[model samples]
Target: NSKPKDTQQSMCTPVCLGASGMVHVLLREELLLKEHILKTIILGQMLSLFICGTAVTSQYLAEQYQVNTPMFQSFINYSLLLLVYTTMLAFRTGSDSLWQILKQRWWKYIFLGLADVEANYMIVKAYQYTTLTSVQLLDCFGIPVLMALSWFILRARYRLIHFLAVAVCLLGVGTMVGADILAGRQDSEGSDVVIGDVLVLLGASLYAISNVSEEYIVKNLSRVEFLGMVGLFGTIISGLQLAIVEHREIMRIQWNWKIALLFTAFALCMFGLYSFMPVVIKVTSATSVNLGILTADLYSLFFGLFLFFYKFSGLYILSFVIIMVGFILYCSTPTRTAEPTALPQPGSTGLDNAALKLEENDSETPAITVQFTRGEAVVVSTD
Candidate 1:
């Protein structure tokens, strides 16, 4: 009887231990998921606020001071980025040092910077041609474009919840548009609505490209690297463009303390947006960031009521609430990487296998795996 009891106890020990381990993993995952959701919401809202600040400042400059130098405004922001991030990058020495990264991937950052600079210019230029409400609403066109890029480039797989959430967010946008029409806030004084709308659409598309590239860089590499490269290249490109296009406008401006202050405010807001965007993008995604920032329009509307003396509408409040709901719904589900493995190229080492083992062993933390193939480092997975 004693021998039989001992045999039964031994048999149950492994099963009990395995069951307990599985439960612990599930509980940890649940906790991590909740933390991720909270961080995403907070960071996303912060970015939305920063962008709203930029929009308000830019609109005020265009309206009050006739400061229509989009290139110059963007150039200021890029210069600040160069002064901050690129300077910090210069001190680091490693494979990721500024010179090393430039040697390996200079062209990539150039395109990224160009896309970002143009996107900013187009959106700012739209302010001179369109209503504040229109810029806010039309800017959301980037969400779908961003999602498509993420699908193809990042291989990000989303669930049905994400699509549903997007629909809800768009529905909220429609509500806002209706409110704008009801309030007669769709048109601005001395503005070309058609041209503004077109510029916004183009800007949004470019923004999608920049944002997708940002996600890839911040997730696979580092935020500092992305900002540093963007700063370096953006400063160069925007400086050249500003000289060519906005020199006359710059000359015509009646310099004043107020105008100078507004420009400084705009630069600071834009710099904050650039600096903090990578944090949200790393935790959530480009698509989600775009979705979350849809509320920036609502923020703009709130300020517009006081600054532009626009009439208030209950629909705007409802629109804000709806967008928040959609953002929350989208974030409730986690987006996972799809088929993360990449094929080995010529002269491949065992690093890819080691990375796979690391990913498996470290399931709790988000891991970025780099596969070396043909003298290049390809990002195989990020989670």
Candidate 2:
């Protein structure tokens, strides 16, 4: 009778342990799935803040320290980003040269580099001829262009209400900037405002194109590797432009601790922007990312309370409320499914195996295998 009882207990032990393991795996997967969207949204917000901070600091540096050469500034930013990517690649692939992959993807990244450098240069230069209000107002136009591009180029889907929300956000931006302009924000003697506005428009359009293309590229490729390739090519492109255009200007800029600090700040923020951008793109559409960034001015406004001793006006408050409504309205929509419509070339593997996240339990006694797709991950037990 004692032998029979002992055998019964032994039989139940493995069954109970296996059931517990299965329950743990399912709970972990469910938690991760829920947190993924939250993580993406937070990253998008951080990207906007970084961009706003970068712009503010860059303006300060230019106004205070007389360091306004766009070419040299871009070159330094791209160079530092490239160095970081190079180091990451070296660590990621020990004993394997990066050139093996570089040879196949050079032109793809060169095009991205060109678009990125041009976008940065044009917007920075536009500030010389136009008021900040004009630049900010016109910059919001990129969202519409990005929306159109997403529909045509990337196959992004949206509802009529979503478009309306975007329009409302645009209206808010216009109101905020228009009030500033009416309050004498523009220089009466500035003669090139029209040209500056046009430049800003062109720059915004180019950025829209670049952002759409980038979203498409990252949807089919590794986010980190794509950024690394862009940084490498952008550095090359910027170096050429700097040598051609800003050779003398770069040599003449005053060098001091403040200038050095500003450069470091700009470089760090730019790097952060590039790194997190792909993640946001992966989690949401290019249009969503643009819409999310519509709040950058809002961030700057709040930041100004501390830094610039700014007093929020009625227009600012109204604009902030309107923008918030649009943001919440936009966020209520579900993410669209952007299938791989076209590859850069025939026989490209980028379209295949997109959502397979690997989970390996190498630290445990018996390893567990998990395969992740869009909705859920399934765990496989190894005996």
Candidate 3:
């Protein structure tokens, strides 16, 4: 009888130990999730502050310094990226060399580079025609466009909570806009508000494209590759555009230490934005990054109070808080994995299917392949 009791006690001990271990694991996982959320929030705001820095510097250049060279400004940023990231990429050793990557995907990077370059130019140029606040707020237009692109192109699926969070963010934007109207600040510093708003919309759309592409590249490929390719193509494209569009403006600028410092500040801020953005996007979705950076407008307003002598509105504070709440809500939930979708099969010709299978198997090492035909299908296979 004592032996039976001893055996029962031994079994009970193992069960209790197993239960304790499971609880510990669950608690640790919960703590890790909370920590990750906190880190993402901090990183997102840092990016926002970097954006604010760029905006403030751009506005100062356009207003006080009378510098309206958008292409030239972007050119500097891209050149810096090329000088830094491209160089780093050259030294990186892996399955493919730098030349191999460029040879294989040069066209795709060109598209990305063009979109990125123009987006920066348009937003910076809008400062000449619109108030800083307008530029900041209108940029949110990209969020919806980004979501749509992600849904189709990136195969990202959103949850009901994500939609709710987005709604909350847009509501914050509405509150801010209302505040701008109440404060009689809508037309302030804006020469042609309509034109500026239109430019912002166009730029925001382009930004959505660039961001979604970046998200895909960084997640599937390498962050260094994305930055390096963007840098290389971006520098070349921006340089050509700058020569055609802003050469005269660049020549006419009255050079001074103050002006030089502002330009340097802008380039550094932009470089920082580009370098760190991939890290954030890799951890979170492009949509979350865009939403997180919405606070950039408030940061700009805070600076504008001192620099532009803008009037303060309480609604702006409320808007900022609301946006933060929405961002937190969105980040609390993990992004869903890309849902499986039907891939386009080979054409009626058996040759196409045979060739596709061969290519797919060859590229299996990287686990991603881009089909140039059939609407540029991206097939990702994982182990």
Candidate number with greatest TM-score: 3
Q: Flag regions of model 2 displaced more than 4 Å.
A: 1-41, 90-97, 187-189, 305-311, 338-383
**CA RMSD of all predictions:** 6.3, 9.6, 7.0
- Tens digit of per-residue lDDT, candidate 2, span 14-55: 999999999999999777755764664576688889888787
Looking at model 1, which ten-residue stretch has the lowest summed lDDT? 350-359
TM-score of each: 0.83, 0.73, 0.84
Tens digit of per-residue lDDT, candidate 3, span 1-383? 99999999999998999999999999999999899889989999999999999989988998898888778888899999899889987886665568888878989999999999999888877867988578767888899999999999988888999999999998898888888788776767788989998999999999999999999999999888888999999999999998898899999999999999999999999999999999999988899999999888789889999999988899999999999899989988876657455555644433342223322335445444444344334454433
What does the lDDT come to for candidate 1? Answer: 0.88
Output the lDDT of residue 26, model 1: 100
Q: lDDT values of the candidates? A: 0.88, 0.75, 0.87
TM-score of model 2 relative to the true fold? 0.73
* Tens digit of per-residue lDDT, candidate 1, span 1-383: 99999999999999999999999999999999888888888888899899889888978988898878888988999999999999989999989899999999999999999999999889878877887677767888899899999999999998999999999999999899899889997775436889998999999999999999999999999999999999999999999999999999999999999999999998999999999999889878988899888888789889989999989999999998998899889999978888756755536554433333344545687777766655566677876
Off by over 4 Å in 3: 92-95, 127-137, 188-195, 339-383
Task: Give the winner by lDDT: 1 or 2.
Answer: 1
Task: State in Å the error of residue 276, model 3.
Answer: 0.9
